[model samples]
Target: MLGLSADNHHPLMLQRVTLGLVSLVAAFLTVTTFFRVELLHHLLWSNGPENNSSCPYGHFRLVGMKDCLSWLSCEMMQSEVTVMKLIGQGAVKQVFLAHWKGNKVALSRLAVSEFSNDFFHGLEMLKGLQSVYVVKLLGYCEDHTILTEYHRFGSLTNINSILEQEDHRSFNTWEVRFRLAIEYAMFLHFLHNSPLGPRVMCDSNDLGKTLSQYLLTADLHVVANDLDALPLVNRSAGLLVKCGARQLQGDFVSPEQLWPFGDDLPFSDDLMPPYDEKTDIWKIPDVTDFLLGQVEGSDVLRLHLFQLHRDCKRNLPQQRPSALRVVQTYKAVYTLLTQESELSGTYSGTSRDL
Candidate 1:
């Protein structure tokens, strides 16, 4: 009692502890409220921002926002997506089968340690597209992984291989090949005629190098799965592909892309051929050839197919027909065959129709 104050030290110490705890709780609540407000503003901006500055190019704005978001920046909750297993590996990324919400999705993971302009721009461009043929981008993870709709049957390349081996009789059917051809042409047409104007949808390597890049959905529809390979023109200003082991070569490479520097000049990265729509156009013939070789029917159909191939491979890019024209031609021939088949028993075929 002598050393203690009038109120007693016990009560005073208890009061000090109570005050400190109260202050701690209040500070915690204040900080938590600020974060919650920011999160809500980001994820639930009901009314779109009035200013352009709120949403800029290459940035991922919310669903209701005035602008879209970059794949890496999308703040997807972990509960929304759960990684299942690794499905594939590519030059720069890994593909995993993941569960997004309740549905199965493909999670393409890119390394965050290295920054890629091409990877970011590709995803940004894909985010803007809403075509039936383009795979849907669900959202993104913090680790720079991209989530998209997964196709069950794999790529066109896989189908092509099976058909080539003639392992499955159903796959070798003329009807299937014809339908695939039409769908492929239509998808390319959609890309070439995009609002962005002839954005190089598919690069030289994957366009015709192998059919496997195209995915065959469970519904039998073909989707351009390698959208990251698609490039946007200068106006969008996002990312550019880094050229390392990717040297333009084989039938996929266009005449303009061929190096004429000769043996004397040193090999330079600057010599890489700049590809455009024509580069894709050049691969059309190869695609047609592969399809025709698989299964063909009727002399008339073969002739028509040959003509389409010839037009697609015209030496000059300008001389080559556009994707729309190619689609029209294929559809016209397809309709004729369908009508004939309806009238007759079935379409006739030759051993070497293509």
Candidate 2:
């Protein structure tokens, strides 16, 4: 959640101020939340900067580029390689549009080839865990390439632009967006509580390790991508041919359904939130609170992401919930928001992120 008086110049120490308010206001409210200031950080959890924990490649270390990436490879995802138009290239990963089995799809690429397996692992986990609010994954490549739907509406910015351009009346669009964000949190919750993944690769290792890892793991990809080539895309997100998708995802609060309950993973200590689904639930109202003229500050969303993030950054993995639980809670919040007379009158804006 963010509040900036439309000037983009927010007040100082706004994160704490805004978070305190969120605590008071949305204490029991359910809304779609945008917690992560960036999705790249959210995905690279332990692999992010600010922390120099041992990498999963045995004992290697990881670094952050200040910003996310937009290009990716095929092996990163769990699918075969094919050319696709570049879509987004945020420092975290690259987004691409491609064709598979005659179906048009979107894919995101990561900077490090090693993390591809983990990238698709998360997607696979999400796939088995169903949710209407969360995006669906058709397939992935181990080369850091992820395949999903190429949502055409663009981001919330694009939607907001359309709303103003169309001269539409004010509506509860913010509320709905907030609700959708929370729904994703609930989705994560179900995942956290769902049966343990037959096998979850928690590292960013190389090919030989990947092969060995596969033998040790189950529910693996049917085949591997032809790693002889790199992934290509058309409209990368930020710059330099980056080609990963950016759905305006912000990793602010942890999902309510997710709890910290796993190996006391050292790398996940900094900025890395445990699996608590509550983290997701905590942040949406913060974003929505600010969005609906609730808060004030520059990059209010970003600041709130950090503030709300404080509560979710616990180091325990077992305490986390799956994405499914976040989705369910968010749905409930969205339903309640629709009941509000003010937003109900103009609840026509779309609340989806593609």
Candidate 3:
């Protein structure tokens, strides 16, 4: 009887050991997977770009961006750049698709001599604002033409069409849209704190006009493309700037941006009240809303942004959040949404295993 009892207990002990080993392996795998996912999340969301140290232009460089070239002179641009076709035209300049040293580029020339001031202003802004947030300036011929990186995707207005294509369907996800919005906010933040002093996006009088000021890169990133009307505001000197001499009437413009005097008075630059950079802050929500697009998770994200958008549209410019604050909030919301999604996926996987 004693020998039989020992044999039975021995088999039971072996069974218990096997069950314990299996649980241990399962736990180990779960921990490993969780850590791997966390690492991936960090890598994807972190704004730091690799290979930035080698950038000779002393500006932040995006991953996969080519090395910066020396500013090309008029002779070099004229000799090397072969104009292909006119791709775009704005009030101030005409953009043509051109080939420069085997790489495609956009060559912009003053549309009319009357718009020379605007063209020169844009060129100066391009030279001064050579950062990751702004379009890459390749070369320029003062008062005549300017060359920059060519974005196949064109302006931000073409985003919907680009995403609708079958080959780019995968990029239509909310994650990608939210990333684009974040980049836009980052660009605004960079502009507001630029070395040239606090500058305002004066060209952004409406949604369409605002979208035209930015370009959509091949990699789905947004960069400031037009800076013709970017003006500086000196708050310390109590100086403010106007978007333009004309009256702007629309919900897109901030309440302060509109003509304060009723229809009883005609619009005049002398009578217009110049506004600070807060005008740009007011348009943030509008631009962000457009960038979010209509994707699977966009509605939920918009709901989350309701309060922030409301604050942005506040009647008082001072009440609105700063660009830096807006950028931080966007990043936080992005992180939260991504984590929730990952958690949901993990829970579903665990339920199936059970």
Candidate 4:
């Protein structure tokens, strides 16, 4: 009537309202898709890009995403890491599935706000780790964290995904896990021996140290920022851990090969503690916590690793055990025992015949 067809007026208003609603939904989803730094109870889930189903990284906090994102600026994106699919978020980043040549790999992108002290410290330790158990190094960009290696399945953080996996290649079999733990133990021992072993060791006690970029996690990996809601992510980890079905004893250890001579020294972080290899001790037991499901007892096997972890955690760093000594104890344990089937009680006390 007002110089416009009745049909035109209805559709126009509806179209405007619909467009506004769509925009709001899109915006909500986009924000929810990234890492949140808030606590689990507080961070409410709204909407976002759909979560990755088969993405190989373990339990990831949702980070932002872009479809077929371009890498025109990053030299590696074009040449080395070919971004094929998006993974999920990390403690400080988002991840992606990329190919280095023909090799399949998972990449992590860190959140800007999550760049706190602990995150960097872990990153520093990760950088110096030239060991195999950790994620492999790769190139990155301003908006992503690139990592490479065989994308086998997932991580300890997301073990259930690998467990429910029906392919003959479930990565969470008790045996494979045994090996993964043992091998990483070797990695820890190597860290103990190397200059990169202790964080302080890498830099002399002399405060004039110029931090090495190679020693920095940020240098090794790039990330997609937005880490304002951390509590949400931490609860996510706890949930993931809770979901795991097959529980390994919290102190189940691998073979003795992981222990080394350098592991026996003491490396303390107590401001003015001496330079030594003791830090390795604390790592082993906590690592044991990761490997074995927690329970308690004196199965000589566990007590050993338990003591190692305890020794390292000691307030008086000098009292700690060495990675070197730890391995030696394993050797001694093996020497006294015969095989996996041999024993009710372990040690020189009384040989409970198998």
Top lDDT hit = 3
Which stretches of candidate 1 lie above 4 Å from their native place?
A: 1-77, 161-171, 206-210, 233-247, 271-275, 296-300, 347-354
Candidate 4 lDDT tens digits, 1-354: 457788888999999999999999989754643322212111111121122222332222223333322222456565667667766554455567777656666665565664654344444444444232234434344444445343333434333343345642333333233223343344345445554423222211111111111111111111112112111112223321110122112222111112222435432222221223343344455544544332122244465455555665665546766555654444333333323323544222211110
lDDT of 3 by residue, 1-354 (tens): 446588698999999999999999999966865664445323443442232224565343333446555778889888999999999998889999999767788899999899899999999888888766788777888757998888888999998999899987777778777777877887888888887888999998889999999998776777889999989999999989998888899888999889999999988889998988889888988888888788778999999888988898899999999988887677667666766788787212211111
Model 2: residue 69 alpha-carbon error in angstroms: 31
Summed backbone clashes in each candidate are 10, 116, 0, 40
In candidate 2, what are the lDDT values of residues 225-293, reduced to their tens digit? Answer: 112111221222321111122111223422322223444633332333322123333443343343333
Weakest 10 consecutive residues of candidate 2 by summed lDDT: 213-222
Q: Deviation in angstroms for 187 in model 1?
A: 1.6
Query: Which ten residues in a row are the worst by lDDT in model 1?
Result: 43-52
Off by over 4 Å in 4: 1-76, 113-134, 140-145, 159-178, 195-197, 200-280, 294-300, 303-313, 330-354
Q: lDDT by residue for model 1 over 1-354, one digit each (tens)?
A: 458776798899999999999999999966855554334322211221122234443343332445455544345636567788988766556788987546677888774436465567657666665455566565665456677767766777666565555444544656557656677777788787786556664444644434755776543446677655665434355433222334455556556555547568756666654545666667776776566553547345667778777877787767888888887777666655654775797753321122
In angstroms, the error of model 1 at 279 is 1.0
Name the candidate, 2 or 3, with the larger TM-score value.
3
The RMSD of every model to the true structure, in order and in angstroms, is 27.1, 21.0, 7.6, 27.8
Quote model 3's TM-score.
0.82
How accurate locally is residue 247 in candidate 4, as Cα lDDT from 0 to 100? 19
